[model samples]
Target: MKKQLTAIFISLLFFQLSISAVEPMKPQEFKADIIIYGGTSAAITAAVQATRMKKTVIIVSPDRHLGGLSASGLGFTDTGNKGVIGGLAREFYHRVYLHYQDKQSWPWQQQTEYGNKGQGTPAIDGTDRTMWIFEPHVAEQIMEDFVKENTLKIYRDELLNRESGVLMKNGNILAITTLSGKKFIGKVFIDTTYEGDLMAAAKVSYHVGREANTTYGENWNGVQTLVFQHQHHFATKIDPYKIPGDKKSGLLAGISNETPSPNGTADDKLQAYCFRMCLTNVPENRVAFPKPDRYNLLDYELLVRVFNSGWKALFNKYDPLPNRKTDTNNHGPFSTDYIGMNYDYPEASYQRRKEIIAAHENYQKGLMYFMATDPRIPKDLQQQLNTWGLAKDEFKDNGNWPHQIYVREARRMIGAFVMSENEVLGKKEVPKPIGMGSYSLDSHHTQRYVTPEGYVQNEGDIGVKAPKPYGISYNAIVPKITECKNLLVPICISSSHIAYGSVRMEPVFMILGESAATAASLAIDNRTAVQEVNYNQLKTLLLKQKQTLNWNGKP
Candidate 1:
């Protein structure tokens, strides 16, 4: 009986092993020549460029949507000097122009009736056949078209397993695993993420918040407690206490009590973030602002005070888009920006980041609901706001809210080279020119604090204009050889806070993305590390691809 029992046990064990052998393995690992992360415009452009170079590439995207802010209701393109835009960045705008040529593209309005106005420039450049301003859905469709045309494989909603996902050997990443156990193996990696998650995961050097002005010898790199270049600051002194001047009443919802450091000092604070809301006046295509479930009347009490102080620029940033829509951004003090609420967002865990994003959404939506329905607001302002509602046709997936939040700034890699205000202002010679940026060195409010005079005020609203277009260094996107050999960061390039202010535009991100991929493909062909890629050959390829490397034209 013992022998028979033993024989039966051995047979059952073999049967189980055979069953396991036939069972399907955990989903096959995705392998490609290049693995591009992030779902921003830069990721799409990089994937397209890699494919054009005849390399197998895949986009491992955390976002389901394609375009970042471009498709997230920033219809008013911030093209400071449109002449400097080239390569796939210019191609994107050309496609936008092509899209508008079709009368069917204008669903809510006629093509002839659509105004060609943009931010201080014509939205449609007839001479170049490029359209700068575009609706959110239009931008998304164009990005999708690029993917479909290139036949690029994109794994959507795949979150990187930041803790232990990166497999490396001798400073080279072998593969990256996502939270769902999906593995992506690649020869080269491009981190186009706004938060630089992959770059941080690879143990690369990076800096969060701002550097001291002395760190990079930049005048605008650090704390600007009194610098109010923009109109985002309060027009008049207002009490910061909940009970208006009662010291024991405590500070209001958004005001901070910490005495700000001296001007030009470094701090671990970030520029404010807000959703570039797409609102429309069309009754049929408008959804009234829905008050959040946890709405608090006191949250916007400061805004009410602003209104009572004769502030009238509430709608200054209600920039127009096609189809009678508006790309509503943060306007005057206490508008859409959730100031000082996102200080930890750059390094926050995924769960924590989501909560932060949710908080921002709630704050912004609540602000709008308050403006449109609250009796404390001026009647004329409320009436004007009531006429506009969320665009019904835009962002249908998330209650017509933009899928992306404007991450004005984030983790910046301290890579092989650092671009600074010197390069942006054409004060220093940039090396290994890859692309150009002409946007102003702009930063939104970073803190809302009580002034020494015992009044509420906003700080760190900077907008120093770039004198002319300047080259972005190839080394700025490359990591040090010892840190990591295979990763490239385009969106969060190596730059001081002041320089990144100029580099952190959507068009410029796309430009850097294309250039990074071109260099990546060359590196793969030569079997060399990204840092060792030949600059002459890279420059040849970039120019052939029509990237504007140097600018001799007027700004």
Candidate 2:
């Protein structure tokens, strides 16, 4: 009996060993020619392009949904010089047009009832066969369609282990391990995230906040204490203190106490971030604005003052989408932008970033709830605001709130070429052009500070238009050869704060992604660094792919 039992135990041990061997030891590994680390529009475009180029590609995304802000309620496209948006970027818009052409795409409103309102053009441009504006779900569906059509492999919700996950050999990234312990190995990697997480982990040199004007010879790179270009600032003087004229009462919650430096000097402050909320007035599909748990009435004390000062432009930025839904953005100074609250977001740890995002969401939600129900707000304005609420059909899985925040600017790589206001304003030439941008050089207010005179005022809102559509350099997307040879950053390209204002649009990101993938493919085929890719050959392929390198007189 003892011998039989011993033999049975040995058999059981061998069976367990066989099972373990079959299970494999290392974390689930994915091998591909190109590894894109983002779920932004840029990631989708890059994956699609690489797959079309017949290269094995994988998107190891940190987001559960794709298309980043484009599918995150920023349906009103910021298409600057729509003609400059070619390649897969243009195809995405065309697909949006195709989706809307079908009657079933519009459920909340009829096609004829929804006027063709867009950014200075018709939303549906029949001549160009593209639709610039769309709903959030439609944009996300298009991204999913791209994934299906291209048969691209995507591992969603896999965040990069920022501390020590990047396995490097001779400055080339061999593999990256996610926090989930999944390892993705690739020949080339694309950092398409808005925050430049992979780029930062790879030890690429980057700059956050504003650079001094002298850094890039840029007119709009640094502090702008009193410069107001758009109607986003205080229309009239408002008090900064909780108790007017009382020094000891302390400044209101949103007002900063420190004095700003001169206009052209540098500071670590970044432009404010807000949710590009999808709101609608359709009774059947409207979900009333829910008050956040930590709602503080005092947080919006300045907004109460704005209302008392007769500020009535709350709906100025309620940009309409395809349906009755609106892409509500920050309009007046105290509307949606939680200024002076996100200075540490660019390099924050994952938990800290979550706290920041939660803080912003809570602030914005309280702002809306206050507007809708507070007696401090004007009755007319309150009634008007009560009509609008979260769109039920959008972001259904996430409490009808956008899953992504508008990370306007973050860690910009100081790469092989740094785009400045000079290049954007046409004062300097751009070499090895990959794409073009014509959006106004714009930045939202960075701070709401109490003036020396003890009055509340905003600072760092800029909107200088680009003279023309300017070329974006390919060198801007590649890191220095000494840093990391295999990685390409399309979203956070090397640019000054002001230059990034124009290049930070979603369509432009998609354009850069396609161009970056093309370069990555060329580099793999040539067995060279991204910086050493033959530009002449890259330009040829980019043009062949129908990317608008130089703005011609065509869309």
Q: Looking at model 2, how many pairs of residues clash?
A: 0
Per-residue error for 36 in candidate 2, Å, reads 0.6
lDDT of candidate 1 over 1-555, digit per residue (tens): 999999999999999999879984585599999999899999999999999999999999999999899999888998889988999999999999998888888778877777778875799888899999888999999999999999989999999999999999998999999998899999999999999999999999999988999998889988898788987888798999989879899999999989889988999999999999999999999999999867998999998899889997877888878888988988888889999999999899999999999999999999999888888899998998899999999999899999999998989999999999999999999999999999999899999999999999999898999888999999999999999999999998999988888899999999999999999999999999999999999999999999999997843
Model 2: per-residue Cα lDDT over 267-329, one tens digit each: 999999999999999999999999997999999888888888888888888999977999888
Candidate 1 all-Cα RMSD: 3.7
Cα shift from native, residue 340, model 1 (Å):
0.6
TM-score of 1: 0.96
Where in model 2 is the C-alpha error above 4 Å?
A: 1-25
RMSD of each: 3.7, 2.5
Flag regions of model 1 displaced more than 4 Å. 1-27
RMSD of 2: 2.5
